[model samples]
Target: MRERPKIKDIAERAGVSVATVSRALSDSALVTAETRQRILDLARELNYRPNVSARSLRTRRSMSVLLVVRDVGNPFYLDILKGVEATAREAGYSVLMGNTESDPARETEYFNMLRDGHADGMILMTGKLPPAGGWSHLPVVVALEMIEGAGLPHVQVDNIGAAREAVEHLISIGHRRIAHISGPLPELMSLHRREGYREAMRNAGLDVPESYEVRGNYLLESGQECCRKLFTLPEPPTALFVANDEMAYGAAYELRRMGHDVPGDVSVVGFDDLYLSKAFYPPLTTVSQPRAEIGHVAMELLLKILSGAEIDCDEPIILPTVLHIRGSTAPPRQ
Candidate 1:
């Protein structure tokens, strides 16, 4: 019977140490790309297969990562999930998804998975942390949203800056009366975006009335509800800056139902430009978040953490955002 190829065989044929072969196979960054490629090519030629189960037993690692998100159904997170899954697969790790829907018990269960070593680490997108187990000494990466004072590695876009830019766009188009539809306040993202909205309005020498800001649960229905309350006001806004594209879509739908023309009766701006934003009736004007990139980076950061490597930078990795000015926005009607 022929013998199965082993790491030792690859190392011997490639003239590299067994440790180098191991590191390269594990996708360790310590190995140079050239060396890793060479090792991989040799491994393929030799028909070498990794014994992940044996390795996991030796390292006492589950060989898996946990990705917990607030809402699995929201397309806002679809690309992020893809990024994480792809990166994990490349690094020879499996990803387990937890859809918490911002539920306390569900979140705690996922946290327990990490604490109990069912997974090596976690990438947390839910705004709140575990209520009981706590996050101390846990390997966690915050993605899409930052949990202030958690002091963990985070990957996200500058919500305040992005929101400010979206709002400012409305102002630039001669919108004097602009309202904001924000997401839930508990999430730092929602607050930061609202802060940006106020900042832009303040900078433009405009007043933000208490009624001008309405909070939603980052859902389509809530956005529709916000529009209902806003449009009834004695002085309804000529434009709106919604915290997310889902809510923005809802606002646009409701406005049309209410007999208002998008960008004709009311201009709209949205954040987290979801995929469908561009294809909508009047293509949405929105802030485009690097969803897939954020996920990919967050997973990479987690992999580094698991590898016991010191991250090059201790600060949160902030990705850039772009504003897509499309058919949804124009100068407010006279």
Candidate 2:
């Protein structure tokens, strides 16, 4: 086998300087797109490989960001992760992953990895804050979840508005006694959504029945249990709005198990229009959060921090949400 080609050899063969070849290979700003493409083609032809470790040492960057989520398998988070992955790859960075599985201790352990420089930056998608011990001085942290005190900047959607919109959609279709299956109460996201539900009900001059709203953990089983509680009430709600898609599926499954037709006997709306929502038995109507865009924007903000760019702390970035109406929602039975 022949020896592997070096950058110098590629530069000589391409008739460009080593610096030009380097910029072309890395797709740097200095190299025009045409020049970069030509250099890249030559490198591919010559089978030249870059020494990532050496380059990292020279640049003092790992060129990687950490994305920590509670459940990596969740479809909503997965879409967001894909967005983050694509954006990071385009920005010439790799993504390091950490799964907490909702375990706070594991989350704390993973967070410690950031302090030791395991990743250039971190995108935390878990709702739990750092362990109540110490760790109040890390850089470039974004709370993609409802976690408070992340000690870094963040990007969040209007949970209140999104929830209100979902609820209002149900009401516009003549749903008065609508119930909400809420996520964890202490979480800012959940609290905001719950408040939105209450606010919408109050604004419409309807009685906000405490018993109609049930707390959940954003889990399937919690949703099922909440559904059971709502159905058992003396007066059941004709419509339900679940906090997330996973729970919405659970509510739908449980409702079907009871021989109730979705959007026929009851209408349902879910949040975080995950991929699963579209493919579900009856496509779920939900509030679509800019899942991947959230990840991309957070990473971009972190990149700005890494570049020593000053950001105004008072102004937090807020992404918008949309309502995706599907087969799951309709006018409640008159």
Candidate 3:
């Protein structure tokens, strides 16, 4: 049998210490760039491959991270996942994704994977944590949503302020009877957005009747159903602030089916300016959350935690959001 090349052979051929070869292969900044390149060339020439399992055993790390998302079908997660994967690859780490569909059992299964050393850390996009609390010992960073009192690090946008801004825009455009299609209240981000909507209505001296607020699952069908119910009201709203772009599309479709013209009889605003938002009829007016940036920062935070770096747990990283004005919004029809 032919013998496999080893790091020792590469180091000897490059006339560098074994530690230099190791550090260079690991992309360590401690090694000079010139020396690192020379060692890397020698390693390539020798076809020496490090044993990942042995390295993991030595370092007690799997060099892989897990990302838990509630719904993989949502386009909202695409950009975020791109950021996570890019950052992980640059750091010589791999990412494993789990779609829980908001199921507790699925969440628990992924948590067990982390505990069993399948991953070095986790970035949670599901909004909800595992029911069993023992996973707190693992390096975890919550992304896009916050779990109140969890004391876990997180990266998210100002849902409240963004919602308020969206609603305020509706109010400014003479939308006295404004309605909100909100996400499920179980998630803190949804709750915060609803509060912002209420705050905006109150500030504008507009009364938000019970009929004006409807719960949605952040899906198109939910938006369509909710919009239908709202339209049946004796006094329907002239504007809607939907929790997401998918729902906004649904609401618009339903409104048109009911013989109303967008921004002509009704105006619509949505959250998360998804890619399709721009291509939608009359282009959606929505809040732009930096999805990729949120993912990048969240993964970076988890990496820091795994490295035993001190972070300000007292402060959660809050990214800003922008309210985009588009053709979908205009003054309420006289």
What lDDT would each prediction earn against the true structure?
A: 0.90, 0.81, 0.88
Q: Give me the candidate number with maximum TM-score.
A: 1
Ranked candidates (TM-score, high to low) = 1, 3, 2
The sequence of per-residue lDDT tens digits that candidate 3 reaches over residues 154-261 is 798899999999999988878899999999986798899999999999998889999999999988999999999999999999999999999999999999999999
For all predicted structures, in order, the TM-scores are 0.94, 0.84, 0.87
- Quick one: how many clashes does candidate 3 have? 0
Between the candidate structures 1 and 3, which one is better when assessed by lDDT?
1
TM-score-wise, the better of 1 and 2 is 1
Number of the candidate with higher TM-score, 2 or 3:
3
Candidate maximizing lDDT:
1
